[model samples]
Target: MAQKDGSTGSRERVLAAAAAMLAEDATAKLSVRAVAARAGVSTGSLRFHFPNQRALQDAVLARIYGHLFPDEQIHDRSLPARDRLVNCLRQALAPTGTGQQARETWTKAYRTYIASAPTEDVRAAYRAMDQAGRRRIEYWLTVLADEGALPKEDQASRVRFLSAVLDGLSIERALPTDESILRSETETLYTAVDCVLGGA
Candidate 1:
């Protein structure tokens, strides 16, 4: 029983450490060695809990998704479907602050992921994060589709279009802009939402 308890404790610690790293930098590499070092556990121990990087990433993302969307507003039938989806997409863009804070955030991102040729690990980390975002957007679309609120459009194409709009808006947040930009952002989000809902 003691051995089992210790094993569970080690696993939790490793997961907590990995999640912390991700929270600190969304594009952080979750190499076993790095996670083990952060967790104060042996690589063998981390591997015992998570057999591979992909497994570890998936687990971490699941944990994060649970925490982030505990009360998912997308399912609120009281609101118009378009409003709910626009709200969901807005939440996805919430992290990109405006003005100087946004500029600093973008600066850090550029230095970390775009300043030079990224290593394979960096590329993999970025891809994992990007895919997670795509999955989330796709999930939102699927929910609306299931409710008959959205047309039976190609889900992948819709996700791509919405993601591109969000990405552009995020970049705009960091640029020099006027106060009206916030209203413009909302208008843009509405436009994108309208496009996906087939102007319904």
Candidate 2:
């Protein structure tokens, strides 16, 4: 059913609601009908916005990416490579909230997404997002090379390796209940980086 005024805002509201639901429960068995019911919209309205699960998944990923990485200048040449890398990793891993409730909720949502056994289309969507993230890593690596911290020839491979490490750490430590643990692990990772770069 069209909104009385034909506002697209209603469609956006439904998408946002679906993203929240997906974030909260990974195995929620979602469908246009279910999401429509959850979003307080008619089934026809949900279908009008998203015709299939793949469409819904892509929309959800887009919303999540926007939330996770807002429009911001991510790299600064003025800072040392290590500092810039640390800043990027921290931003990527920063917890969204201070308390256990928020941490658990966000962690659960992230875990669900990571565990997704998506369809071919959903997998392609994930791959595109992964490539974007890897590009960010490569950008940092290029900056590091310009700063003489790493060799320029292997920058792409090096960034992929570093990104994998950071992704592992994000899954492990990003949801810490204690700020001390988060700080300690981050400092430990930075120390490892320092040792590696010290010889360069």
Candidate 3:
């Protein structure tokens, strides 16, 4: 079991290396040799964990999703319902805690995933991540309702409206903006979230 655990840890390290490489430089083509070197593992070892290059890519995509669109539940019942909702949506928007530079890198990586070049498998991985993001939003909403923080109203409508507002702010942030305006995005997001959740 110890032996298996070591190998498992190594495998995870290789995947993390690849994901970081993908996030650090989005334009660089991810080659087997490159990833192996970046991961500080022999090519044979990399292949031992991942049967093929495509398999490694798939693992990297999964790792990215784990950061970008997590399915894990966040239980912060200590906070007020409004605060919990704010924290939850803030997490959903940027699970990686990525700043502007890192966020741009991730954006580029995603654009490549949906590009015309990759095989269907690679593209499909990305599509699944989209579904996972939606499900995560619903999961948090359900938790809030169950906690009696949010009223047991139309959860679906709340998710949709909140998602739209968040996504819109996300898009707007992509554009060049002054620091004051960018800083306000957080307060604005909380205000919008509070209003939509009927807690304002």
Best by TM-score: 1
Instruction: Show model 3 residue runs off by greater than 4 Å.
Output: 1-74, 95-103, 106-110, 113-123
- Indicate the residue-level lDDT of 185 in model 3: 66
- Kindly indicate the candidate among 1 and 2 with the higher lDDT: 1
Q: What is candidate 1's lDDT per residue for 26-105, written digit by digit as tens?
A: 66779999999999999999998899976686577666765888778787899998899889988998887878888888
Off by over 4 Å in 1: 1-68
For model 3 the TM-score comes to: 0.50
- lDDT per residue for candidate 3 within 1-200, as digits (tens), equals 43754777668778888878766654345688888888788888888889886567556755665576465434555667677767777766664333575468557756777454788766666556554555456666666666776765676677677777766666555555556544676787788767766752
Candidate 2 yields a Cα-based lDDT of: 0.63
Consecutive 10-residue window with the lowest summed lDDT within model 1: 57-66
Model 1 pairs in collision:
none
Q: Global CA lDDT of candidate 1, please? A: 0.82
